[model samples]
Target: MEDALRRQQTERLVDHLERMGPGRVWRPVVDRDGTVLAEGGGPLPDNLEEYISGVDFAGKSVVDLGSNLGFYSFLAARRGARRVLGLDIDADAVLGARMLAALHGMGGVDFEVCDFLKTPPSIKADMVLAIDFIGRAVVAKGRLDQVLATVARLARREIVLTMRAVYPLEGLPPLEPGLRERYAKHISDGKFHAARYAAHALGHAWKGRTIHEGRVDGYVLKSVLVFSSNVAETWEEQGGSS
Candidate 1:
């Protein structure tokens, strides 16, 4: 009963914040391990939790690429990361992350506004998070391989990458017609590189499955692709040059 009430309260708070603007509000949820942070959006999948928890950020530093609204970054700080830099190409996201840190009184967290994949190579972190980032940016730009290589170089210890996987390197979906017309010249001309890179990167042997789907203004679905830092041979070559 108490748990239900708490969730109801949190949902009410989320409603209030939604009315106000595009920021995040969260509440704590209690379980066997004590209180775990639960955002207004409700529970995330356990796979995501496992991925985030694998990064041993306790008393360490982290770089969050494509840190949308900063859900994971906040969780990392709560888990004892010494410093967390939330980087995003969107200025509003960066500001929102800063506001969230201040609102929660977590001073060690910071936000950076930059195209992180294009930022100076000197910036490094113990762990780098590229969750749901490559498909939106690199694949859209037909540069998936470059981005994956970059993710590896940016992290000293590990790179956490998640995106959709394409098999056969030929049967993948093309960019939607409207998006292709607005962003590029053609749709079915091999302009988007999701398939080729997946073939080269994973050799069609990596496991994959659907992860999330919902109606967000329009119905959309996304798959999760996880590539570990240990698999980035290109990044290893780049490291030798520096």
Candidate 2:
């Protein structure tokens, strides 16, 4: 009986891990009741622990923009976030998030139908998440800067931004100047967002100007811009910007 019980327990444990790590490139994480919590497009580029630790999501209140299926939002809740507000432009995504939250009996997380770019200036948050959802084009006429400034304003503590940059590295061929300009517009839009945040006192007073944090490995020459929400003198004391 003991041996059989041990085998059963092992099977159960294996089942749990399998459920937790579905191993799909981009799969919707559903609760026991089949409510979608999160979605990603490809196999996880990194492990859960490494991703969470790298992003530093512990105990923070997160604002997830373009939350798609709620993958990161659910992870935030599991990793000790006090509250997570998942916002997406799509009604379907919002419904999926709410269902997923219910499935897990997760109370501190909620979803809304709002554009991250249009989030009002009055709200301040610990973290703002805008992962690769800078959809469509970034440049056109005069609107590029306006778009970026909106992003900057939404972030009170830090902005976890993941958008393609304007320039390409050696391995990558040069995209047309127009394309580069478009990408550049996106970055500038984010900066514009920062400027608005600064202007409205939603974040630190405009500190000098924005700085590039260098390219993430996969992003190549395209840099990961780190815009701060604190005065320059206090940045180091405040744990640096992302």
Candidate 3:
């Protein structure tokens, strides 16, 4: 009887995934019994541990910004986070993450649809994650400064910011028509470089320490910048770099 019930549950979960279409995802989301629910096209970030090296999420409140499928949020909960909230702009992704949490019985984690730039969550968190979000922002709206300011406000203790770094590589090919048209202005304005973007974005009085700086893929230079609210204020008072 138990085996039959388990099979039925697995079938239902698979169906749910099918309805959510498999596409560009950052990480693969799996169930408690190791059933793969969704498959992402990007390479698995095997260096995730290194990316979050010094930060400890145990007993902490974490907020994952742009939490497309809640992979990092689930990781935080698994690592003993007291509370985990996953926020994303995509309504479908948010719903899918919520369903996955329910399926895994992770009561400590929650998912919500939010625009991190315009209407961020009001609650502050011990740790915040902004992985793979900055690059897209550079192309989409070029409002990195506003986004970083909001992140600084929402983060209490620390923030883990991961973005593609600027490198001496060939320029990106033209995107699809709709996206290309949207990104043309920013691209022509030269807003895609990582260092320049960070410099402009973090113009506010926030201090950050580089945790990890390296290449995630051939074209992407993944960098993790860690920030603490208290430390930032102290650095600003001491006339240190923002």
Candidate 4:
């Protein structure tokens, strides 16, 4: 009887995936029995374990911005994060993440559809993950300073920000006229060095520290910037003028 029920449940899950299409990111998401459910095509070239191996999320409140399929959020919950919130602008992604969470019995991790550029969540977190978010914002011509300020405000201890970059410099490279016009179509944003610069700027603005930085190999050349809290102060003091 139990075997029959398990088979039925697995069939339902697989049916859902067939109806929804492939995951936007976090490819080859599998079940405990190693059943491949969704094949992803995003830029996450590494596994979740490799991406989150060094971080200490135990007993922390974690927020994952631009969390396509709740990959990092579920990993944080598994790693003992007290509370995990995953937010993305895609409604379908959010819905799929919720379904996956329910199937896996991960009630602690919550998924929401939100545009972090316009309005970030009200809750502050011990750690915030903003991976692969900057180039899209650049294509949209979003204010990079305001975006950084919002991340700084919501992160109580640390922030892990990653973006695609051409050079390891503090500013972006110039684009040709043709390339600029192509980027305006929302296909790509050329290359961006603003994430590293913005991370450092936020560290100075909030009196934090640039704790770590390195490259993350993927479909594109990516860089990771980590900012750690160095001082204790009221929200008003830490929230610099926008």
Which candidate should be chosen as best, given lDDT against the real structure? 3
Model 3 ranges with Cα > 4 A deviation: 1-9, 43-47, 136-140, 167-193, 196-205, 214-221, 230-242
- Highest TM-score scorer: 3
- The parts of candidate 2 lying over 4 Å away from their true place are 1-27, 30-40, 44-49, 118-122, 139-147, 166-227, 230-242
lDDT leaderboard ranking: 3, 4, 1, 2
TM-score of each: 0.55, 0.55, 0.74, 0.71
Deviating ranges (above 4 Å) for candidate 1: 1-51, 167-242
- Model 2, 60-94: lDDT tens digits are 88887777657777777878888898887776657
Q: What are the per-model C-alpha RMSD values against the true structure?
A: 9.5, 9.1, 5.8, 7.4
Q: Which pairs, if any, clash in model 3?
A: none
Candidate 1 lDDT, 103-161, residue by residue in tens:
45677888888775566346888777666565554554555656666666676665555
Report lDDT (Cα) of residue 123, candidate 1: 82
The Cα local distance difference test for each model comes to 0.53, 0.52, 0.66, 0.64
Q: Please give the lDDT score for candidate 3.
A: 0.66
lDDT, residue 177, candidate 3: 42
Position 20, candidate 2: lDDT? 43
Higher-ranked by lDDT: 1 or 2:
1
